[model samples]
Target: MSASMPQKRYYRQRAHSNPMADHTFDYPVCPEEMDWSQLYPHFFSPMDERHDRDPDKGKHGVEFADVGCGYGGLLVELSRLFPEKLILGLEIRVKVSDYVQDRIKSLRAAEPGHYQNIACLRSNAMKYLPNFFTKGQGMVYTMTDVEEVHLWMVKHFTEHPLFCQVAEEDLVNDIIISRLGTCTEEGKKVQRNGGKNFLAVFRRVEDECK
Candidate 1:
């Protein structure tokens, strides 16, 4: 995702949403105030109001997010492959979001650590990207499937010893510094006569480059 220098911008309000899976137009005034313990209680300790009130004490947060995640199929797939990465699915529909939450619970009960890193939440991702994700982790896409680019990236990342391919569980044995996204195509206005959405997956060495 290409981002221009930071500048103040105004966003229009979205007043309409599906009532079946209705959502409230609420968001954090700032990222620090957002409590992630509700999303992944097992991973982090309960919030201490004293610590939470301190501006310097931030709670544990998700490193990966699936915006507009429908039924959470992709997140379910990712849970097995990237078991150590904290992943969250954002769904606008209430019922759908609840289902994903339950799905994760069942999977965890069946096999404990298989799903400790996955979670889901109900929110309007298009409007509240910053509320749940930090600037470096939030990924928005503008292009569709580009196989040539994917192939080249895979080759480059694989050749680099710091990075490894994520094809099965236990993909990352060591503590990671940071990770990039899968081939993402959230924004593709003009498609190639007949093109499909894309997803990308890559991780870079931390402290290597900003």
Candidate 2:
């Protein structure tokens, strides 16, 4: 009699990948990298009641950002309103980014101060938000996804002790913050009349304090 041993078989599979993925664009880079003057040309004055701007300067600086700036229009207006605060616009599309870059160049040349406080960058906002924001370092401002940034703020602010110390009043006086498709119906109504054009408020609350 002879003893039999079990045989084991191994299988291997080829990798599934796309060649274009390697050269894909990363949106939402930091504010300092790109020049807004070469991206957005027209400046809309917020005080004129036609555009959007964070009127509370005593609360935050011009060091704000727009994570997914579609056309760089909002950033232009923001620059005019908060000339002291440095504004950053982050976009992913190569065509749009290039257009904004050129627009900003023309705007700056036409009116030097039109974009004096503005800049732009191209990167993925979701991945780089934490890196861009450092514990109450700057007055975080945006009109992008409310739920996304809200959660990010709550989490980031909790992790970073410096963020927890921000004053409520200071937050209130920070900016006229709002988002698209947030209150979709009401937002559209306002945008239609060119009155306010957006909804904004300052929310500086501690969700999980340590």
RMSD of 2: 19.3
Residue runs of model 2 more than 4 Å from their true location after superposition: 1-62, 130-133, 139-175, 178-210
Candidate 2 structure, TM-score to reference: 0.47
Count clashing pairs, candidate 1.
6
Top TM-score: which candidate number?
1
Q: Which ten residues in a row have the lowest lDDT in candidate 2?
A: 6-15
Candidate 1 deviation (Cα RMSD): 13.1
lDDT by residue for model 2 (46-104), tens:
33353333334312433567766645667766766777666777666555555556656
Candidate 2, lDDT over the whole model = 0.49
TM-score of each: 0.53, 0.47
Q: Per-residue error at 35 for model 1, in Å? A: 1.8
Report every candidate's CA lDDT: 0.56, 0.49
